[model samples]
Target: MVVGSMISQIELVLNELPESEKKVAEYILANAKEVMHMTIHDLATKAEASSAAVVRFCRSLGIDGFPALKIRLSAEVENTPHVGYFDVESNETVHSIIDKMLSNTILTFQNTASQLDAQSIEQAVSLLQQAEVIYVYGIGASFIIAEDAAQKWLRLGKNVYAISDRHLLAAAMATKSENAVFWGISYSGETREVIQLIKRAKEQGIKTISLTRPGNNKLSQLADVSLFTSRAPEAQLRSAATSSRFAQLFVLDIVFSAYASAQHDFTVEQLAKTRKMIEILYD
Candidate 1:
């Protein structure tokens, strides 16, 4: 089976594990590709559990042993392309910036595309298309992307709610149902408030989506559909966030445009009406 199939299977079996084994199960589910590259000791260390626990965790998944599990995981990783990371220097020239930015953007697209599951994107778009209410939450730089998503969906005639206030957003999530979609955008995927809101949405049975950097993080683990941006490591000046943010928003635009194209006539009419309204206002 393919890596995506393995991941789907793991997700299906995740809730069946005992509470003690669940932690390791969660870690494996979130970090399946990365786990293949890690040693048994390294995997145990990262999961903050012992080797015995890790073995038991694998057994719970119906794998014969760690080596067999690792072999299957390695196959999954081999099928996926690797992402590259570059560091930017402080005194970089304009030409250097252009070159680095282009490289970073290309790498970001490649990485994101490699990890993109067509079914998940389709599922997310379906949820967004049918959602009666959509709430987006993010903090700092991610907040900007959340706002972008809100704007795009709003223009497409969807009811979008994006607020910077954590408490207010959490309250909004409480009143929503499966017809509502809560999107959580975070780069590190460990942002406390975003994670908290997504958790609340999950408890409320609201559809949840996450956009974050490619890695194992709490936000992705809890999300119904997880979309990853490129993994750009931060420097002293924090150029990573700056470049990756644009890349992520670009992906969002692609998703929005694709969705609009899928409903071409309706979206076209909507766009024309919006333009006419704006033109009348300007006149």
Candidate 2:
């Protein structure tokens, strides 16, 4: 956990915990304010779980230990409670829909930003910059993020390819340059195609980057550099993509902006050239 709301992180990993660990998570979720004052032993006894289970739960959240978890909970408990995703109702008003969606997006961005690791982001940028060719892959909604990422780097004159077809991407990976990079976007961190391609990329000795939601995941575990977005709970009509996608895009903007900032003059020149080219198309 970088610096955002700790409670949200707990919720994000709640479902992933084991039966005994889930008990600890449930207790904390219900009594976050009180948990701030209770000792680890107290919490373990109250949650009906052991001290080891408590420690395991904390580790699952990327927290070092029970004391750290309490400190984080105390800090966030005083703030306004975390506003989770709300499903759009059949009878929802237009105004209500707008408000709910806006709130969700804002929270998603805040949480995602808080959890970001500056060093990890820096490493990812360096890899992208050193890469001679970049291949980005995602499936369905994630494909949109992959394409957007390709365009951002393309404007900087990078040879970036965002191929939606898994077969084609695999073919490209086979002949990828030694200095190539692969970026994978899967919110769940478990998309089969993305995983398969990342494995291929690694086999070819290409540096790999993964964009996924916060928490332990297969994709992040496999990537050389891991970036995370906020977890968006399921929504009936929206399927959580509305906020999750925005969160993914938000992370992308941060990475792209950081990359651009590192090469200020080059980025400015390239952006100017691309802008002029777009203007020419309009003319």
Q: Which candidate has the top score in lDDT?
A: 2
> 1-283, model 2: which lDDT tens digit per residue?
4567677767777787899999999999999888999989999999999999999998777678999888888777786677766678888899998888887777788788876889999999999999999999999999999999999999999999899888988898888758999999999999999999999999999999999987888999999999988788766788388888999999999999999999999999999999999999988
Stretches of candidate 1 off by over 4 Å are 1-85, 176-178
**Which tens-of-lDDT digit does each residue in 1-283 have in candidate 1?**
1232334335434565566567777787788878877887887888887888888876654456788777866765667444334557878898987777776666655545545556777878888888999999999988999999998888778888999999988887787665899999998899999999999888998989998865568999899888876555545555677767876786687678778978999998888888888899988
How high is each candidate's TM-score? 0.68, 0.94
In model 1, how large is the Cα lDDT of residue 202? 88
Model 1, C-alpha of 121: deviation from truth (Å)? 0.5
Report the error of model 1 at residue 1, Å: 15
Against the true structure, candidate 2 has what lDDT?
0.88
Reference-based TM-score, model 2: 0.94
Alpha-carbon RMSD, each predicted model:
8.4, 1.6
